[model samples]
Target: MTETADAVTTGTERPDFPLDRRRCPLAVPQEYERMREENPLAPVTNRMTGKPVWALTRYRDVRQVLGDPSMSSNARNPSYPAQFHVPEEMLPYIAFPFPAMDPPEHTVRRRMVIPEFTAARINKLRPRMQQIVDTQIDQMLAKGGPLDLMAELALPVPALLFCEMLGVDPVHIGYFRRYAETTTGRDSTQEAVAGAIAEMDEFLDELITEKTKNPGDDLLSRIAARLPDEPTLEHEDLVAIARVLVIAGSDTTANVVSLGTVVLLEHPEQLAELKADPSLWPGAVEELLRFLSILDSATVRVATHDVEVSGGTIRQGEGVLALNGAANWDPERFPEPDRFDIHRNAEGHLAFSYGNHMCPGANLARMQLETVFRTLFERIPELRLAADVDKLSYMFDAHAYGLHELPVTW
Candidate 1:
């Protein structure tokens, strides 16, 4: 059954929720716009679930659902929204530490790693981030034009930074990066995902043991420090935490850097404005975050109790997908939502989401982006796409929405 603005439909007539990546830069799906204006909380079929779930499109409704305590993020819940079907053998392995937990447990697990992501900690890394950005740019310049930007700069910047942060031995980065790619890429096969997980589990188990014996200032050592009293996080928990951190921190920033660069290049006027004034970099980052919301469904909440939203009622046990892309485009919240104006204040945008589950790595991602964007155009003023924008291949099936490879010339 599908719920529409004025009536309900059965079987063959369900309103389909299209979740494909955008073909045009900075464009929200047309279906999202239609639902927001017409059926703000329409019941549409999740292609993966084959069940009618609430697709909350309006900004207010999406934010409310994100912040609502009654809504559960735990995938273990009977009615929890699992975007893809998990194999029976893998059910127990999918309970990710914090992002997939709720309440006190979520709060506790997050607290363990909070110190690593604090503003001061992130601020301390700016110099190193700048160095990484510089080295990548220097190599690109030496190689001269016609480089795949994704490989030359975008992918390496964050991958190297994450390795430094995690204190993984430089020798292991090759395999680690391969495992991460397989695990996070949506198009990766089940066998590949399982192999990646097993490889990571073995590596992290040894790393955590080593860190326990000789603790360092890195995050793994910090987790080792908590092992004694935090019985909730056993050996398996430590591996889970490390795996999640690695998967979460790497590609997301890389994609943002690539996609954000494309967006800026598309609007030479905005690019020139930013290049002329470095002071605008911070605000420009925020606008880019808002304008290029990579995830179609950033926050998926399962209602534990009946809740009345602005448009309609979300029944208990029903899954609700809050589309950040749609909410970012809501006209009520952002004035002239479609326009990409770096001068506009896009501060309150839901790019990193809101409330308790907001991405902890947001500050780190911002600093990297600010540094990279500031330095790239400043160094190579003639930078432009090597091929027509339409000719570039995009990662529609990746965990993060980005170009498969951004070819560029300077």
Candidate 2:
């Protein structure tokens, strides 16, 4: 497809293979545009398995596959060519909480847990989210010097919220945070990530045991309470679900807090407008999610049957990538796709994905981001980036696209 522009037939040969390996693929907009224009679906050697596989880059194509029954979401397929193994410790959540399942199955598992992230449910947590925001800002102010918004604010709010939601003991939150970062890191070695996963597993194993007797009002307890009557899922499945709820909820929202701050600081006029009118916070948060594009990879899927996607024929059993980041910025979908506007029409953005597998944590993440943006702008009207914009660092190879640290101050 597209004449195989720069067709790469060989990659490095190494153990763990292409897992955790990242090659910068989108440094040029034209390159991204070319793929979108001429080749939205094309073949490339599977970075892990060394077999040719399909990559779906356009919005419509990616969405189609996301909703396609012919493609499976089991990320643990040993034959599935992945860029990385999720490590055995994190294996329980390879696609748990219904993220890695197909419908009928995903639908049932997801329905069993939907009440936790419902609009009404998350709204009840907003004040707590706001309080976290307020307290973090107060602490940042008290520090009275250069403040990295990510470390001081963005990263913690979600960690605390997720810990509250999953019934993770606050005293042990420091332990889980390490795993959260490691599991989410694309550049981190497998050994370190495996250790973090082991730590989380051991910690959660003990918590799950304790919750059986002294269940709290958190998600793990609620889901655990349902296991006896639920025929499709077991105790292990439920425990795995709780693990995903904590990890996905924490990492995605934290990135939003961190990257969203960088986006606002880069756009001072919009930042000023936000400070003046806090009412616009929710829309602004959604817009930031669109602009920042944290998730660079698609939720992986395996072609269960031969399917023609975007004029390219993918064989049965071939691997496919649903490139949401490329799709979210599609010119045909978003007018002036590359520009960032706080009020941009984001009806089609895929930052949290779409279809039956759409992120269950979307409402909670938006709430946390909305609250942080509201508080940060309200209290620090003159907030701006502390370093030269060009010099600011980004984790280009990260599983999620985000700033390494957002240094900001009033």
Candidate 3:
């Protein structure tokens, strides 16, 4: 029973959503190429929920789905394709993150923090970001190799920087990391996920209070300062915003640092190009982003109204999963999409996604990625994988795609 775009199929009829890429960690799932070629808007069963969703694979269709105003990001919508199960009690905590929000409210809240992540702001913070990366590399050098790059450098650099950005005490970075991992961990129990959220909320509540009383030159303090003028925003709203920043900022950047390193090492020619020409570092970062689309599965939405896409119509309230990884690897957009060429114009890639809901911290992520890759390789020219690439454990089950650990030696 082949499921068409308009037909709602049951049981084994539909292909599973979130096709696994564990076998080829650096590439989008092989199934995506077929879907893009055949049924651009293919129907799939959500592995987590066993519900049908319209999977958008083509580059243009993905952009349209993401940019379309009728597509709602609200996970609370009954028909939305939920990645994991959240207990009813945990719904309040899980549902309201700005990324999962829709409409004018999302616009207002997103606008409030837009100034913090502008290219100028990230550029201003570049020196500090460089120092952070250098500090991590220095520590790694001091301790020596055969160690997990993820633990030593990849995770800490972003975690520490996010702590500084949000005015949270750096001493509590371990808790922040735990919150990120547990919340996104596919195997995490509902109770465990709820507990992590509760802990973060408690800590954020205290931090927000302190920021309100003694404002500093940080995101939380700045948002706190505006609380008086913003009548609709509440104390909890501040905590929610801070929580989003902590998880999104730390986890995604950390993953990129670890995964990007792996990709660069695999392609020494591109690595050499970066080493030879420092100016190419930025473009290399973009290409790495395109090649390693870590947030492939996070861009889930439900159509608010019947919307016509490339292949077929997404009926009102139907779930739509825009596979950013597939879009990035779409041959229609990038010629020779499988080839990891640093010089290729990889701009407009869906790595950070498209439209109003595009990642607000994209510039910050880019700066961190640029700083880390440029510095890490230059400092340790001999750095190579200590363990075989095939033996490495990739985080295929998590909400984001990355590595559990990257073993490297110089």
**Best candidate per TM-score, number?**
3
CA lDDT of each prediction against the hidden true structure: 0.80, 0.69, 0.86
lDDT by residue for model 1 (1-410), tens? 23332234454355655477455645777777888887788777765545667888899998999999998898777566555444546766564657878978888777777788889999999999999999999999999989999988888888888888888866665676677668656557677777778778888888888888999988789777987877766777777788878876667888888888888999999999899999999999998888888766757888888888864688778888888889998999998888989998998888888889998888888898999999999999999999988777787766567887999997
Q: Number of clashes in every candidate structure?
A: 0, 2, 0
Off by over 4 Å in 1: 1-18, 22-25, 229-231
Model 2 per-residue lDDT tens digits across residues 168-259: 76665566656666776656777876666566666666777788789898888887787787788776676667667667755677777776
Q: Pick by lDDT: which candidate is best? A: 3
- For residues 1-410, write the lDDT of model 3, one tens digit per residue: 23444476654357877877876778889988888887888888887777788898899999998999899998778787877667545455463677888877788789779989988888999889889888888999998887899999999998888889988789988888888889887778878877887888898899889988988999889988877777777888878888888888679989989999999999999899899898999999999999989889889899989888874778888899999999999999998899999999999999888999999988988888999999999999899999998888899888888899999988
Ranking by lDDT: 3, 1, 2
Task: Give the C-alpha lDDT of model 2.
Answer: 0.69
Model 1 poorest ten-residue lDDT run = 1-10
TM-score for each candidate, following the candidate numbering: 0.93, 0.88, 0.96
Point out where model 3 deviates above 4 Å.
Answer: 1-7, 10-12, 88-95
- The TM-score between candidate 3 and the true structure equals 0.96
